[model samples]
Target: MPVPPPPADLTTIAHALQERLGPARWFDAHTHIGQHDPDGMTATAEEILAGLDHAGHERALTFAMHEPDGYRQANDVVLEASRASDGRLLPLARIAPGAPGALEEARRCLDAGALGFKLHPRSDAFALTHPDVDAVVALAAERRGPVLFHAGRGIPQLSEAAVALAERHPGARLILAHAAVSDLGLLAEPAARLPNLFFDTSWWHPSDLLQLFATVPPGQILYASDMPYGPGTFSAFAFLRCCAAVGIPDDAVREMVGAQLDRVVTGADPVDLGRAVGSARLGERSLPLERVASYTAVAMQLGYRGVDATEAVALARCGAQTTGTGPEAELLRYVDGLLARAEERLAAAADDDAPARMAAVLDAVVAGFLAATTSAGVPPVAL
Candidate 1:
């Protein structure tokens, strides 16, 4: 089935807000400029520059994709591109903790004017708290730049592990990319506790971004697209829509969009970390149509098996109701209902291990839904 378009008013508002903010003040904290993946996804420095131009961004932190032969050559590509761009692009080197000479390579990149480092624990198949990863974080601490970690939906480098590492290395500016895309609530307390830990809004989920903005301090959030790898234009547009829909203050939105990142890259006094502005205080604007669509898509994509026709119809009905109400309260109730049904099903499962596994998935879904709904100014409803 074809996806529906967002409401015209919502799109207009998002574009108007984007225009008001202007691109010069925006800095994409995460992006890549090389070929690496088997699917042949590649982005050249010029293409990245054009993307930034199209997005109205003045600068971006650019890095190379993870190369199979290690990132030595890839790092060289990023350095050359940044040098050629004359500072329009800031370079970060991608490092595999388990790779040979990873520490030495990191030091070399830093010396060669690389601004920071990017680590993907899932791709590298290493633990976030591994000694070698610590070595890289220590390197970033010395350089006084951020260490961006890919944290979501993968093994060994979950947000909790990243939080532990950030706690251990107080001096390192650790950025949890994708806002810990899957388990953002898990990072809330850690983000509040660790002044050095930061979050980048780069994932596709609006609910996660809204929760992060509501839960984490403004200073701890950075705007990022993960562009050329993820959809560049869509990501930026979605971010703007989220800011508008959530009614974030203009000044705070400005910081999340770019200013705070400018300070971080320049080694200036860090933006002051403040207490979280809870969802109720943030704003109670109606959820945008695009966001409702996002929520429905996620619900339909839930991997639960044995979803009978009756359950599917109920889920669809809830989705339709959410669209009509345009209120997060309705969506929250829908998710709560789904969770209740999942629990009842698990209770009757014949296999013990099946129940345990299903329970884990349901638990994650419930946590995410509650976080999003709470941030959207909807009180939790008992299941």
Candidate 2:
């Protein structure tokens, strides 16, 4: 394939973004930050802030998992990180509907300066569409804060009903995290009918962003990086490129993607870390490209491999290419080549074992790209 000329003054765009926003103030709409697994990115409060800073995020609103063994500890960690960032971090608390102190804890999170609540029906063990879940939404409405929910396929009906609840409460904010292309179709009705509903862009394919911009209003969108879930900041950068590609002008990108998150960032009050749990934060003492690689390797173990991951990472590195030549460009070509190879492999892999092997190879290719691109700090090419 013939290489297209590089986008005009891409370096100037990066420099402008770095200067204007001081690392682009990404409000990570949904991240499992408070989980204290020793194997996870699992770092201290100070470490989480430094990592966010290094990743170019000004702030992130994090949520705790709703499972028992460590639920309260997770909330404690999110609280601590929010405090340590001096409001640069926004905390989102988790409430498993039937948990012993679910309601009381959610209310306390509001009092403790949590910006919102996050509900994961699969992990939390309840339907977001359930009557009990309605009480949670009502509480958020009563408190004047937002609620973020997991919305996607093969999950419970709560994702849809949650939209209905948001429609019912116009004053309350309802964020659909990881708004996929399928989600765009699912959310269109409720979002169009309801002004308070918002969508978060995290670890999604770049194509989904294009679909969304063509369909939804710019103001209804928000930028997020599911950090240390880690493709590094490439996830956020891809969103920017997608916005730019779709003729969502730079100012609008900065406004809806950057400034809107910044507005949410500034509203956060720090958690009192002295009394909060320390285990829920990222354990990194400092930022290192290797740390990012290590964390992403875990996601690899989680069986989340896909061709889009490689393409998205490649596109990000392309955007960061200042000279439009050198190794970054070479890597872009490699990714393009790999996609061609993957398609061929997919077709030829008639046996189950062959398909699995091909998928594993693709996953490794993605991992290698992620490691190299992040270390280089080169933005990705627009797909």
Per-residue lDDT tens digits of candidate 2, residues 38-95? 4333334554455466545666677764445736667877887778777776788887
Off by over 4 Å in 2: 1-24, 35-44, 180-182, 262-383
TM-score: model 2 vs. ground truth: 0.65
Q: Where does candidate 1 clash, by residue pair?
A: 23-56
Query: Please, what are the lDDT tens digits per residue for candidate 1 over residues 60-96?
Result: 8988776777889999999999999977899988899
lDDT of each: 0.66, 0.53
